[model samples]
Target chain A: MRAAVYHGPRDVRVEDVPEPELDGPDDAIVRVTHTAVCGSDLWFYRGESDRDPGSTVGHEPMGIVEAVGEDVRSVAPGDRVFAPFKISCGSCEFCRTGLHTSCVESDGWGGDNGGAQGEKVRCPNADGTLVRVPDRYADDEDALRSLLPLTDVMGTGHHAIVSAGVDAGDTCVVVGDGAVGLCAVLAAHRRGASQIVAVGHHEDRLALAEEFGATDVVAERGEAAIDRVRELTGGGASHVAECVGAASSMEAAVEVCRPGGTVGYVGVPHGLDGGLDLFSFFGDNVTLRGGVAPVRAYAEELMADVLQGTLDPAPVFTKTVDLEHIEDGYRAMDEREAIKVLVEV
Target chain B: MRAAVYHGPRDVRVEDVPEPELDGPDDAIVRVTHTAVCGSDLWFYRGESDRDPGSTVGHEPMGIVEAVGEDVRSVAPGDRVFAPFKISCGSCEFCRTGLHTSCVESDGWGGDNGGAQGEKVRCPNADGTLVRVPDRYADDEDALRSLLPLTDVMGTGHHAIVSAGVDAGDTCVVVGDGAVGLCAVLAAHRRGASQIVAVGHHEDRLALAEEFGATDVVAERGEAAIDRVRELTGGGASHVAECVGAASSMEAAVEVCRPGGTVGYVGVPHGLDGGLDLFSFFGDNVTLRGGVAPVRAYAEELMADVLQGTLDPAPVFTKTVDLEHIEDGYRAMDEREAIKVLVEV
Candidate 1:
């Protein structure tokens, strides 16, 4: 199998790798047909976060099931399916409560599992981790492309809205204009947010945010951004979705929330140059919520919307690549030249 | 007029002061009959938190309305009433949503309004800030005592539970055994928590926690406490009520929450000798919530429970003092010689 493996900082290679084999009764082999490079992936690529030099990369996977262990039931060979970034046991206490990210028996794609940005990957707890595409749309190319993001960004964006407890009449401030942030704008609109404010520096990304249902945008930085958002919100919005994992981004998210509001964060927290001071939110009675999102929990609902044409997060993939040029996808995203890169495997 | 004035650290004195007059049309002069020295007061008293030497201090005030400004309506001259720590205009956007603490027109007890620990307090936004007691309990000393804590700790404790979203069958871990923590145990039980664990160092307070409806108690510190709590709850609890604001207390509160759980805090954050790191909670998907609780928001409901004999936070006022010995009340609380002190004005 050909896989994208981490070579070192700024070096991702599509090289021949041994095919993954089922290591457990609940495992399944997936022949990935689509995958994407994530903002988080850049962490390791930039050498800012720890990642083994030879480890596999990428988490999102949309593919056809090549084989399934005898214990698997929800999915089987020849089924078109998609897997959430994290593998989970559906019946575990956490999973049963819709906290699949905290499932008692869980494993994440990439690394030992073989990268999703590859020809084949092994999925643990297939019944819990994989969602089969309806046979009717399995051969619908555009629909399949739309469903790809449900495996990660789209679901994570939904998690931000859910964690923030956004309501129909609420004002939501979305920090960052990345794929997840843009999806969050759409999610907030779908959840009936009366006003959605997208704050970021990129004019183009901010424009996409507006197209995705943002009622306002603030292209300022630091205190100026907080001031602009607070001004537009008459103090601050009732809900804030933090989609960037930077200390400054978290600060802006918290500062742009009204008293008794909530800041739902899906960003993988990074760059805590020191510790993040959260005392201001405490005084304002703002709740800090969310984490590594339970993307699996939200995938079904998000996929439903995508299929019904009520949501279209696929637009976030501004660029596309093939297996051999996966390195370009990484470069494009790292340089902010692409919102997200879709690899048509 | 007499009021409690801060002379310096460990020095509180009840001294003659200028009487309060109608400062605004929304004001009322409250003849405080009962007030309690709070745990937070000890912060300023011990010089741990900044306090002006000549500033009047105390937020809790339960009394008979001596006079009301022409515009005051919800409360009147001679009406028996109590005020939440922070005064708010009942009609503000924040107030309409039950976040009175963040009201656009807001003021607090203490300082220029005249300290609640004294003979009288001139309340701004009397209609919004003061809650009138029924005529039946206006002269009923015992019922009034039970309602006093509702002015602060009782409602604050309720805020913790509300913020944590504890529900039937949820296991709640309360970190702190102070009056607010003990009250949180009661609050969690009221909200129908199946199992309540109280964590604290004080044996007497822990015993009180059991009486207040904690199903278990962990009288340990640091790692031992975390380990014991994790073991007892089989990997932490679903809800954590943080009633003590110390960094360690917040850390313990977050550490004991299961993934997807929430930590509701009410302690006046004082000792932030350094920034607090919250990355662990982010990794676990646990939410950190609650803050300067909108005590007024939960006061009426809490008062109803207290008046109905279903909830009684009065026991937390374990000692009694009169105006002349107000300094003793402060000392008792500051020295940890009393859980709290009830001041008979």
Candidate 2:
């Protein structure tokens, strides 16, 4: 089986790796049908994260179950399913409270079980971690595309907005232009935010944000972007989504939020050596929420919306490549040639 | 009129200050019947805050309105009322949304207006900042003592629990032994916390916490305290009130919160040069809320409980001093001779 393997910084190789097999009684084998390069993956590909050099990559994937161990009850062979980035036992105190992202049994980042960007991958805790899509949409590519993002990106975006307590009539600011940030705009829109401001520097991404229901766009960075959002919203936005994990984006999210507002931060923090200003956030009466997203907790409802044709998050996949060209997908996304790269497995 | 004036660090003098007059259209002159030495007041007495020397310094007060300006409609002269620590215009976006602590027109920390530890105070935004008490309890000292803490300490404590989203069946942790933290235990109890764990070092304060409704008390500090709390709660408390402003206390508050739980922090942060670890908090999926408490927002409800005899928080006042002996109140509180000092103005 061929799998995307990381060799070193800015290096990825599709190598003929040993195929994954059901290793635990609760595990299942998934034949990858679709996967994508995540914005967070850039941290490792760019030699930024402390991720081991030779580790298998990819955390997002949707596929058909090819085999299941004895204890796997919720999913069966040949069932179409979405695998959340984080695996969970579903019965722990954390998972029981819908905090699957912090499930004690699973490795926090999906590395312990198997990588998704492969022909065949092992999924642990299959009954709790995998969401089976309705059979009616199994043959529909567009519907599948819409559901794919729910496995991680769309669900995570929803987490950001929900964590920030975005409600109807709220002015929401999304500070990032990546696929997740764009999805956050859609999430805020779906959540009935009265005004949605997307802050990003890229014209193309900002345009995509507008398409995804952003009522305003701030093309500036740092303080200028916050100023634009404040001006557009008539003050500060009542809710903000910090979709980019960079310190500057976090600052922008806090700056744009109104007093007593919340900043839902979902971006994986990178290079935040200076730490967050507790005094400033305290003074502003801002609440910061959203962490490793409990995607599995939100995936069912979001997928239902996708299946019903009410939500189409496929636009976030600006470009798609064959599984053999997965390396190009990484390059395109890393070099800013694509907003998000979807790999057809 | 005599008022407690800041002479310098470790120095407070009851000097003859000019009598307060109704200066603004919305102002009222309150003849302060009672004031208290707050834990935060010690910050000034110890020269921790940037409070100006010779400035009047107290925030908690309850008294009878002596005079009211023409625009003061909600409160009238001779009415018994409580003045919250922070004055608010009640008309700004922040105040309207119940974030009166962040009111635009009034300095968030009541600096522009005179302090409460005086014979009289010119209360700004009287209609919004003062909550009128029903005349039935005007002559009841116990009721006054119960209501006095609501002006700042109790309300701030309530803010911490409320901000942390403590609800029925929740396990809550209060992370301080100060009057505010003790009140937090009571707040959590009133809010229906099933198990309230008070974390502090002082045996006397912890005993007060038990009286105020702490189901468990962990007298350890730092990591040991966190371990004890985690063990007691079987993992971590669902809600935490960080009433101590030290970095260690804040860290403990976050450490003891369950995944996706909230930590309401009302402590005025000091010596937080390192800031908070965003990465750890993000990974744990914890939410940090609470700023300077919007006492005016919660005072009315809390005071109602006091007036109705549903709550008797006066036990927190271990000692009382007359206005002339106000310096002794400060000394007793500073030396830890008292939990809280009630000042008979």
Candidate 3:
């Protein structure tokens, strides 16, 4: 089998690798039909994260179940499915509470939970971690693009908006116009946010954000962006979704939120330290919510949305490549040339 | 009229000051019947906060309305009332949403918001800012002490527990043993927390916390305290109320919250900077809520609890002093000699 293997920073190659097989009673072998390059992938491809050499690095993948262990009940061989980035036991206290992203036994593919980037991926705890794709939308390419995000980014974006309690007729400000940020704009729109502000310096991404339902865009960063958001939203945004995990973006999210509003952050933090200003947080009564997305929890809902055409998140995919050119897809994402790159297996 | 005035750090003097008078159409002048020395008052008394010299330093006071402006309707002359430490115009958007502390027209008594605090205090937006004392408990000394915290600490504690979403049978952790922290312990108890852990270093405060329904007390600080809380609560507390505004306390609160649980903070931050960790936050799915307390929103409920004897938070007051001895009271609190000090006018 061939797999996209990480060799070093900005170095990846499609190399012949041993095919994944069902190892545990609950494991399933997925023949990758469609996988996407995520913004998180840039972390390892750019050497920003601790990526082991030769590790397979994809987490967003939807495919047909080529084989399944005896214990797998919900999914069977040849069944189309969407696997969440984090695999969970689904019975842990965290999972029971719908926090599958933080499932006690869940593992992230290629990161801390082991690698998954390959033509055939092995998923453990298949019954709890894999959601079968409905037949009505199996052939819908756009719906498949939407499925890729459900494994991570789109679910994450929805988590950011929902956890922040973004309701109808409310104003929301999204920091960082990356793929997840754009998805958040969509999530906010779907959840009935009356006004959405997408803040970023990337013109193309900002335009995509508008297409995804952003009512306004701020090209500035930090305090200037916050000031503009405040000006545009009358006083300040009722909810702020922080999609970039940097300290500056988090601070700006807090600053742009109206007193007593909330800031939901879903970005992976790098080089950030310390706690929030308790005085300002308390003085303004700001609520901050975020963490690993409960992807599995939202998988069914997001898939239903995709199937029903109520949400069209496929526009976030700016590029697509064959599995053989997965390396180039990673590079394009790392260089910010594509909002999201989908790899066809 | 005699009032407690701050001259400098460690320098408070009871001096003759001009009596307060109605300054706005919605203002009402009140002769303070009782004033409590708050932990925040020490901030100005110790010159920790940027406060001007000669500023009258009391904010938590219950008084009899002496005069009312033409537009004052809810509160009239001779009515006994309690006003939150922060004065707010109820018509603001923030106020309408039950966040009176963040009201656009709200002002703190001494810190930042320039307003008078003396033997006679003027309350603006009287109809919305003042809570009338029930006649049945107005003359009860203990009941009046209960009203003291309603102005700030107790209300703040309630806000913390409420924000943390402490439900019946859930385990809660209260960090800090100050007035607000102890009050949080009581608030969680009132909410039917099955087990409550009060983390603090002081024995007297811990005892008060225990009396107020803290089932366990963790005397250790930092990671050690977190470990104790985790061990005591099986895995970790379902909710944590951080009442100390330090970085270490905030970190501890976040560390002890179970995945999907909440960390509510009410303490005023001293000098903490930086934002929460996004990667860990995103991975854990923790919710952080805190800010200026919605005291006015909860005033009626809390007052009813006090009048009905379902809550007895007045035991937190360890000392009583005449207005002339306010300086000594401040020193007692600064030195940790008193849990809380109440002043009689």
Candidate 4:
């Protein structure tokens, strides 16, 4: 198997590596057909976040199941499937309650379990992690492209808006123009939000957000963006999605929400030396919900939508590459040359 | 008319003051019959929260309508009524959405409006803020006693549970033995929480919590309380309410919430000189909701329950004093001699 390995900062190499073997009866092997570099991956790629030199990378995976261990009943060999970024034992209290990210037996898609970016990766807790694609669309390339993001970003965006309690006739403010933020706009639209405001600094991404069903877009930053959002939505929106977890962005997300509103925050919290300034949330009666998304909990609904042709998030992938040139995909994402690079395994 | 006035730390004086007069078209004057000294009052009483010397005191008001402005229609002179601690314009975006605490033209029951502990109070947003008791129960002393706490603590506790999304068969954990916390136990009980755990310090108060439907009580504090609660709930509860707004207590409330759980915090966030640690919340997928309780929004439903004899938070009032002895009431509350003091005006 050839997997992408971190050599150092700005260095991700596709190297021949030993294939992952099942270490537990709940495990399964997935031959990666599609994967992508995530925004979080840029952390280690830029040397901002530390990573072991030879550790495998990537957390999103869509592929065909090559084999399954003894206890894997729901999915078997040759089934077209995909797994969420986080692996979990579905029967745990957390997973049963739809909080798979906090599952007691949870682990990520890297290191010993093998990276989703690899040609062949071992998946623990297969019954609780893998989502079998319907046979009717398993060979459909466009459908696979649309369904790929459901394994992570799409579900994450849905989690953000859903946690914020976005409902029909709601005015939703989505802060960030990243793939996750754009998907949140799409999600708010699907959830019947009457008005969607996408806030970001990138013009191209903002345009994409508009295409994703944003009724309004605020390209400004800080106070100006807050002013425009408030002006557009009367006082402020009741549902705001914080896609960028930086303190300033989260604070702005709170500011743009109406009193008693909720800010669903899915972005990984970083650069917050002293955590968050929660006094503002307390004073304004704002709720802060969401964390690392439990994508496995949301995969079925999103896949159904994709299969029905009512939802397509493939537009988020602006570039595509083969497994042999996975390094170029990382470079493009790190340099902002692509919104997201789809790795064609 | 007489009212409690702040002199200094540990010094509250009852002094004659001019009777309140209608100042706005939406104003109404209420002859206060019942008021209570709140846990928050101790902040100013202890000189921890800044206050103007000689300011009128108290907020919870349940009384008779003595006068009404030309525009005050829903509530008129001679109606038996109660108002929330925070005054609201009822028609603003925030108020119409049931977020009365953030009403644009909002104010409090002190200063020119007269303290709720006074003989009379001038209400600015009478139509929006006042909840009239049915004439059937207006003169029922027992019903009035049960309804009075709805003006503040009871409604606050209800807000905490409601925001935490406590549903039938839920396991709820309530932190704090204050009036609000005790009321929270009652609220969670009413919300159909199957197992309610009350975490507080006072054995007597925890006993009251048991009466209010706390199936379990942890008399411990800090990490011990967290451990005990986690053990009792078999991990942690999905609904935990924070009625005491200290950082340590709120953090404990968060710690006791299971992944994807919500911490409904009605405690006014005070003493947090810096801010809060939100990293724990993000990592565990915990939601932080609720703030200054929008008591007015909860008043009608609670009042209905009280009038029907299904709810009674009256036991929270462990002592009673006439208007002339309000200073003594404050002293007793300050010394922890009373869980709460009911002031009969």
Maximum-lDDT candidate = 4
* Two-way lDDT contest, 1 vs 2, winner: 1
Write model 4 residue lDDT over A201-306, tens digit each, in one string: 9999999998989999999988999999999999889899999888899889999998888999999987776667877798779999998899899999988888
Better of 2 and 3 by DockQ: 2
> Each candidate's TM vs. the true structure?
0.95, 0.94, 0.93, 0.93
lDDT of each: 0.89, 0.86, 0.83, 0.91
lDDT of prediction 2: 0.86
How big a share of the true inter-chain contacts is recovered in candidate 1?
A: 0.80
Docking class of 3: medium
For model 1, what is the alpha-carbon lDDT of residue A180?
90
In candidate 1, how many clashes are counted? 0
* TM-score winner between candidates 1 and 3: 1
Across all candidates, what is each one's fraction of true contacts kept? Answer: 0.80, 0.83, 0.89, 0.82
A1-345 in candidate 2: lDDT tens per residue? 778888888888887777777788999889889988888888889888767766778888788999999999999998998888888888888888889988899653334455788777788889989999888887688898888888788988999999888999888999899988999999999889988999998999999999989998889866777778889988887789999888888888888888989999999876677677777688868998889899888888888777777788899998899878988998999999998888888
Residue-level lDDT tens digits of model 3 in B1-345: 888778889998888876666777998888887888888777777777877787778888688988998998888888889889878888888888899988888776643322234578878788879899977776777789877788878898999999989989989999999989999999999999999999999988898888899999999876788899899989888799989877678778888888888888887776465644344445688788877678888888998998888987787789888888887788999998988888888
lDDT of 2 by residue, B166-234 (tens): 998889999999899999999999988999999999998999899899999999877889999999998
Model 1, position A218, has a per-residue lDDT of 96
Instruction: State the weakest 10-residue window (summed lDDT) of model 4 chain A.
Output: A270-279
Model 1 spans with C-alpha error above 4 angstroms: none
- Name the lDDT value of residue B210 in candidate 2: 96
Compute the lDDT of residue A108 as modeled in candidate 2: 36
